[model samples]
Target: MSSDNPTPTPGGPTRRPSLDETGELPRFLDSATSDEPIGNVKPEGDLAGRRFPLTTGFSALVRNRHALSTLIRRDLAVKYQATVMGYFWSLLEPLGMAFIYFFVFGIVMGANDKDVVPGSDASFVLYIVSGVFVWQWFSAAVTQAANSLGGQSALITVMKVPREVFPISVVFARFAEYLAGFPIIIIIAATFGHGVFGWNLLWILPAILLQAMTLVGIGFMLAAGNVLVRDIQRFLPLVMRMLFYGSAILFTMDRVSDSGLGQKLPWVTYLYEHNPLVVLFQMHRAVWIPGLAPDQVGIMSATFFAVIMMFLGRWVFYKLEPRVLKAL
Candidate 1:
């Protein structure tokens, strides 16, 4: 080698990335910026920070199930640690709500005397409690999930675990609370009217599973989205409140399905019947009460909706992940 053209040494100044290699100078600069905080992610290459497929994300969750469990436990402990009643607070909340709704709608509104559901002897109390249980699980999982990522900014910055685990963990933890409260529903069913055990009772398992899957999907989307838009956190509670009224928590689906409203607004009735959470709630109510069987079509529809939401949430989460990290 000539003196003017020295051979490249083992240790030398790093070469600046070429346009072909970096793709865009601004992106390269953003990546190079020292002020950007280190997070659970480290981006590189052409596909760095790109969206992952649903299968890939789910498999990652399955593979990291232990970490997910730990997160779930930690979340539960932290949430109730300060409270005197601890986890029992979960049962108490819905119990209190059940009483209030039972008094207002069941007594004052004369739901106690009427069969809110056709062909069943279940009172309005039984009807409302059943729906309230489902709502508690669904609403808690989803609302907490919306804050899962943003609330754990410290963990996001330090933990190298799969990001999806945070939101899914919230779902699992709230599910534990749901399970603890399930006995109350069973006791109410047996004490208030019919016995809880029956052939149709087997259907509650699938109903719960389908609802969990749907919530997981919502969790993924909301968790990722809330990281970017704090407005999502503020807006979710109002949405959940609206869902409570619209989901037939206080009334019977049959009323709307067979009423003048149904005749005039057939499309509205269709939407309500097909609403996945509505289906799940009605399925829960049916299996708990005597003389009713869950609508097989509703169960099937809920399953399909859950599958679709899972796909949608996974797609949206991965799509927004790169930007979410930056926003957080």
Candidate 2:
């Protein structure tokens, strides 16, 4: 080599990134005017960003089921852990609520005027219990989803996993707890001999699918909002309370027919059909209670709403996720 050949430094440069003595090696063409990365390992820059589409989001959510399921189980454990009895409270919640509704609707006002009685033929309890079952699940999902982000602030602030997963998992956790009471519902309906049976009973399955979709969508949206607005957690219960009475849970929608204003009410029918949660309640009644349930229109409407709620809610959640950590 010629004497002019470049001499290597005796003590080489440190492994850390920096400008060379001549500021030449590994330098960019626009180094003087740019803030672009000059290191081998640049920041991922808002890693875990939301650039994926709806399908990808859902697929990712599904893949994270273990994390989701753990949260759900933890919630259930925490819920009963504070109470006197543990799992028994699950059945007690609906049963206690059912008794209250029974007194108010069935006994207090003599409101079981439609002969909505329970027997080997057709049970009123089953009709009412079906409503309780579906409503509890829907309400749980909604209520939990709304508070999910706020509740998981610690996890959100520290964890590397998806942020949306926290709220979505909360919804699922509540759902799993809500479902724990279902076998009791089915048994009550079956024991009285007033149950509807056979292949037709399967129709409730579709309504359930619709209801689940609706809950997930609404859950994500509520969870996102709850993170930003602390008041939402308190306000959501009030909203669900009103919805419970208006949702046609204890009594049939036909019960409103005697009052012309409620009967002639056009939107009532629309809400009944379009709200997937309501539709699931009515669907369970239609399949479980023999010779009851007016028509299938409500279930159809609910299915439609479920589809709309799911897509829109998911979009909103994805849109909000990037800012969620900051808000939390």
Candidate 3:
């Protein structure tokens, strides 16, 4: 008869085979007893050999939707922890930014909506507040997502969840903040006498979807790249500063076009209009200032850019995942 336990040697005590000797269990399962460090152990079984498709990030998020939600909640809680105002900070930051910009451009500089925005009766305050609100979400998401992987290296190493969840959670958490601030934007628009109700409001949905898609794609690339090259984390702030001025957040594309530089170099306006954020900000402003909306060609081009970035980001992430794991 055979025994379930290891058999005793003739002269020595019984001993079970180590995972390395047996080669029956996956290497990852042997981490507890293995002499090698956990971080150095390469994954085995499905994790090691599985082939991921281009939709892997999307599919992973969907399959682990519950985990993703829990992560988002955890992030939100951690972010506002020890704070008295908590969630209101999300609304306050962008609102405060709007106030400063309104003071500078609307009052100090005397920027008129009729001339700067053109065809929009909305005041300069509403125009800038609307842009700032959405831009806050984009900026926060990108900055947080870029560091998500490295920041939670220990959790990521231990958790069996999808790696993409880390960056995606940051994106959604900022998105939650974005949604929370929408009411403030509405109140400002209504107070400024900009009509908030109309079929044009439907444009907000696509604008949001496009921005989310773009952010997720950028998040994937930045998250992975930051792990490999630590300089990304250091250098990102400067890039964001440039993007803030270039993205039409504080000024309209029309304002740029009417400027002396734009008039002297017409291609400058063309390049500025082609910026994805320009189109996205215009779409967002379109909710109240319909004339600020991008044309069909601009909309299509932005959509194409979003789609391409998403695919490319996922591919880069997975392709470099092994190296990222080793680095972590």
Candidate 4:
């Protein structure tokens, strides 16, 4: 007459006991395993109590920063090794791009007359350099981030570190390179007779940090997406190209906003204003401009979005990471 049930209370009906209940409180004449608790058996020294694997993603990032930095240095060094130009290419890349763009748009195409251009009083060189300067850093970071997971496919498949680290590290690595190249832009600006630079202009620091956050967020999302759908590699380039046009790459934000074109697409106006890269440009112009320092409103907004995106990105990455590894 015994059943797989807990001993009834003195005045209560029979109830089933939890798996943890003692054998005396539960029994079944026919259920052979009923005496056993159903659960994972513990391994000795389970130093950290077993817990959600998701938190492990962030914990790994914090614990493995040294490993992360080594990966970043390895990536950058791979690009520089055996090249005669070595690190010179980092500073030269944006300079070469600006030169080509200037010759094509400002000199040959007469874009200087373009009202959408800012700093018309300044040399066309300065105006073009500024936009190129802004666009290149972000572009480089995005490109690096997009390919980050794919590049580390081996490390991910072979090792147990957080996969999100690869993409975020790529963004961080490119940001470092961007920072190193920043002096090149300022020196060129000063040499061109367009800027009155000072240490006070260093307000650009927070703006740069905010931009890196946006990159990390978008990079994490894209990297996670790319893990399963390989064609994203193709789609991302097109998206980035469109971003350059939508952002202030070849024009001034004020000119683009005031051109009455944004009126046609009110939603587009909001998106442009809200995008991280666009915010950075506004902040960049404020600091890089001759007399401007930085906009408090712009800095606050950029920092806020940066934080939101970083958290959101890490959340998304952690949530998707388990499935993402399966694909790899």
Candidate 5:
């Protein structure tokens, strides 16, 4: 007579576990489910390929905060471990960019003669350096986050940790770099030509928070999209370059707003004012110089945009996360 039952593998069943059970119930269910019930059962074989919702993604991140923090520290340490200058390179990079932009634009192009900040004592050098410092933080965070997933394939494939942690870690690590360079900016602002300090420096709190939110949103979208289309990785640098020039990094938004181009096309003013980076740069400069404040309307608009992008990007990341892992 034929055997009634097929033999199991040496240790267990031959078939793989359901992705829902493998991914969700055991880890996310125990604590988070106490408040919000999770009805996700072991998904059937056909349905197991689908992605989890945003709730699951957020829960995973919250549960893994310690691991996430460790990853951020490890990423930062590994980046500069063997280097001579080490963390000092972070300060030098933006400082060097400030000098180059100051020479080429402020000195050679005579931008120094024009007053970007009306009635403020700050000079072109101060303006460029302040903007460059913040821009470097934003660019480096988003770029590193975009590559975070692809770069940590070994970890992601083997570890039970949340994938979102990888991109979020990149954002935090780059923010650390920004924090490292901040004191230098303060000294430069105090000592350099016409740069001044005032109570407005408190505005930096909101600016950093808003910019961090914007970067996290960008990180989510790019990290997931890069997995599906590797071409996104190749094209990202070009996109960053376009954003750099378009965002008025070297000059002030007032220059754009008051320019002939801005006069002819009112949309140019609308566009720059609505941009998160423009709003951020304005806030940074306001903090560094007295008698300057970011446009209230622009700040409001950018904050709203940042919130939308944050939710939308998280949705996209969680939606495609399964496909991303499968492709890898």
Candidate 6:
């Protein structure tokens, strides 16, 4: 008598047993296939079809907060591993730059605190050091975040996590380093007789929030764009260098107005006033030098741009993610 199960000949396709004989569908038939749709089963490559609401990216970030913290820790650990004077290097580089700028502008060119930031009692050293510390974070975050996705292609492709985590982690890591240097800033301020305790210190919170928003927005765009076009990673350094000088790191907007450049070239000062970096720098410096506090117009402009860049960055990142994954 023939058995119910069909035996296949060597090198031949086995016939699927009938449901009556097996009492159930074959394993292959029971499983969903690419050609057939199943109830509530999302299609392959469905990311393209999903609606990208304004909160989608932020919601993903919120859901993946633990993952973000892990990434931030890993990045910090990798950055400091196998290095002597690890975190101190972050303080040293900016401190060194502050010294160089102080020498060139304060001594060589004879620019004084009164001349650079008029009406501010803070010494020139305090002014430059404060600006340098913050600028270091800004520069490092932008540079690292731009290349964050490209450098970690292996992790990004293998891990099923939000790609934004990489760039945002870099921003937080650099911000941590920035915060680490605060004691030094405080020491400098105290030494110069510019008391750090004042109502003006309240401004630091909003200043930091605005900057974080700006950097996150910029990071999203740069990280996604770099994956698509590798040239972005190369071109960013040049742009950053230009931004350093134009950002009023070595001087202040007050000095610019005092020099009458705004009158001679109204557009030049207008651009200077509107540049987010300049506005951000002013906000940060205003904490120590209250005279440098930005007017209502500057604050409003910066706030508007920060909001726009954030939403715009998320939109671009979402639009490009599909192509980015393929390119990766």
The best candidate in terms of TM-score: 3
Task: Report lDDT (Cα) of residue 136, candidate 5.
Answer: 94
TM-score against truth, every candidate: 0.80, 0.75, 0.83, 0.73, 0.81, 0.81
Query: Model 2 off-target regions past 4 Å?
Result: 1-56, 113-120, 262-276, 290-296
State the lDDT of candidate 3 residue by residue for 1-328, as single tens digits.
1222465678999976543355343333222323333343466554553222222457657766876787788799888987999999999999999889989987888777675455657788888898899999999999999999999875565555557888889999999999999999888878874745688899899998999889998999999999999999999999999999988887766678889999999998987897777898889988887777788878988899889888888888888877887677
lDDT of 4 by residue, 32-119 (tens): 2223231232212422232112335566678767657766786788789889998888878887888898898767777663343344
Ten residues in a row with the worst lDDT in model 3? Answer: 25-34
Error of 6 at 307 (Å): 0.6
Candidate 4 ranges with C-alpha deviation above 4 Å: 1-59, 113-121, 257-275, 290-301
Please state the error at residue 107 of candidate 5 in Å.
Answer: 0.4
Give lDDT: candidate 5, residue 163: 74
RMSD of each: 12.8, 13.5, 10.6, 17.0, 9.8, 12.9
Locate the minimum summed-lDDT window of 10 residues in model 5.
24-33
Candidate 5: how many backbone clashes? 0
Model 2 TM-score is: 0.75
CA lDDT of each candidate? 0.75, 0.65, 0.79, 0.65, 0.75, 0.77
1-328 per-residue lDDT for model 2 (tens digits): 3222355655884233332333332221212223433222222345323222222466656765665665666677777877778888777888788878877877786765345533336656666777787787788788877878777664444333445666667666656766677788778867963576776587677756777788888887888887777788888889999999877787765565445665678676655544555556666677676445435675567777788888898898877765665565
Ranking by lDDT: 3, 6, 5, 1, 4, 2
Number of clashing pairs per prediction, in order = 0, 3, 0, 0, 0, 0
What does candidate 6's lDDT look like per residue over 1-328, in tens digits? 1234575757888765544455442322222211222223222463433222222457777876776787787787778877998888888999999999999988898878776455657788887898899999999999999889888865554344467878899999999999999899888887873745688888799899999999999999999999888899889999999999888888766667656777788788877887777888878877887877888888998999889888888888878876776676
Model 2 whole-model lDDT (C-alpha atoms): 0.65
Tell me the tens digit of each residue's lDDT in model 5 across 47-82: 343332223667778877876876787788788989
For candidate 4, the clash count comes to: 0
Model 3 deviation from the true structure expressed as Cα RMSD, one decimal place: 10.6
Q: Locate the minimum summed-lDDT window of 10 residues in model 1.
A: 25-34
